[model samples]
Target: MSDDLLNAQNDLARALVEARLLLPSGVPGLFGRGTVLEDVIERIDALVVRTAEGDGARAERWRFPPILPRALLEKSEYLSAMPQLAGSVHAFDGTVQDHQKLLARVHGGEDYGDLQKQTDVALVPAACYPVYPIVASDGPLREGGRLVDVFSYCFRHEPSPDPARLQSFRMHEYVRIAPDADDARAFRDGWIDRGLLLLRGLGLAAERAPANDPFFGRAGKLLAVNQRDQELKFELVCPITSAEKPTALASANYHQDHFGSLFGIKNADGTTAHTACVGFGVERVAIALFKTHGIDVAAWPVDVRARLWAP
Candidate 1:
């Protein structure tokens, strides 16, 4: 990160805080949002839904909790790929003596890490993780496969001063499961265009480009290389805090039989289903809107406001 880019991010963060659009929680990348900011997020989400509807996407809607079964995470092999970003849930399931020890440590301002035990649930890392199991449980998919609309609050362990990189954020996703790889690839490719148009329609200067996940370690680097080589992911990016290094506000990904194999999802022909998903970072889009047009929503361009607010 260049000094100029860092300065730009800091300035934007301060401006949003001063405008009461972001309420600092004394933590970087974690803050409460003001009503206007939240309203913008809501409008953006609704606009995506309307666009999906207009495109004849009759997806099954699902809203998931912020956490998922730890077993599912293990089955998905997410820990192997990006354990550094995973947030595991832990709790104090102990005897009375252990409780007394915990309380004593609390009073003495000491660590009580030994007393807590890992729970069955873990914070959801992505909006689409929970959709695979449900789709699998329904048995083999039909001839054409399925489309699902899912929304969830996602968590990652990254702590950054850049406001665009939030530790906890909402993701709105549309996932498609198909029997053929071509269909799955087509879904992702189409979304790359649609997502770009949607953000640009919101008066944002957004661009679409091939991208890769932040896979960890040496082995993960190889995986990321293969992913990029296969053109498995693409992101719609816009300049939120820094124009030089834009933030990815949305992504279109083609997961070829990865989730299907793990979750036992299959097609009518007894082959693993190929999957693709397009996800939007709701809060990031709202932040991009504020950065692009001005913090004051009422003073935004008439056509942009109409697109977001008009009935």
Candidate 2:
């Protein structure tokens, strides 16, 4: 990471802001999308839906809200590993005097943001977290498996200047649950191939590589090493802001029986269900497309346009 390379990345970030492709909201890692970027994101999502349909997987589709029950997240114990990135919703529940003081602080240009109290819900950390509990509550699977497609706006507190790393973003996920471990593993492997091909169709040269979550703190380094050693996470990365270091626009993860054991999801024969998921960072892929093919949508390659906007 040379200083010159860092400067170049910052220049691109400024260019995007000037071009109205990105609108900074005075908050780092959070930006308002202009029409052009929003259109690109929508088209990318449509392409994902089309590709998922063509994969011949009969998956139940679901759309989840940006926030989920805090208790549900607590049960998953995600905070134990990644509390640094979690976003909890807060609100002002106060009397008139309290409101007056808060209003005065804001009018006087003070740091009044902390006046809000924590709510019962937390912004969802990942699109797939809300799905496991839903599936588990249904008891054992009669057919030995289940396939589902879920999409949601995920929130993390990470603040960075990189355009691809937003505090709030949408994730499109396809998840599989099965009694046999091999069934889930094979499903994940198949999606890795399909996801790479989908990126190629968009004129993005992506490669599948081993990856790990940004686990928090000292104990997390060991967790990350173990995860990579187990080969549990794979990412489809293409260079967006940097040529040498590519960005991960999508990932395929094998959860094994981790969620199943916690949720009590089981097979009819009484075996814990194995789980796997493939997730696409919708905005990140759109950013890569703009970086690779230029920001002008109409001038993009005809094949790329066709694949994204095809009927």
TM-score of each: 0.96, 0.93
lDDT of each: 0.91, 0.87
Local error of candidate 2 at 17, Å? 2.7
Sliding window of 10 residues with minimal summed lDDT for model 2:
4-13
Off by over 4 Å in 1: none
Q: Write the per-residue lDDT of candidate 2 for residues 1-311, one digit (tens) a residue.
A: 67866776677678778879889898877888889988888888887887788655588998889999998888887887788999888889888988998999989999876778888999999899988999988888758488889999999898877888899989999998877789888888988999999999899989998985789998888878987988888999998877777889999999888889988898888889999999999989988888888878899999999888787
TM-score, predicted candidate 1 vs. hidden true structure? 0.96
> Tens digit of lDDT per residue, candidate 1, span 1-311?
78888888899899999998999998898999998888999999999988788545489989889999999999999998899999989999999999999999999999998899999999999999999999999998987888999999899999988988999999999999888899999999988988888999999999987775788999899988988898999999998877767899999999999998999899877889999999999999999999999988999999999999969
Q: Candidate 1's C-alpha lDDT?
A: 0.91
**Among these predicted structures, which one has the highest TM-score?**
1
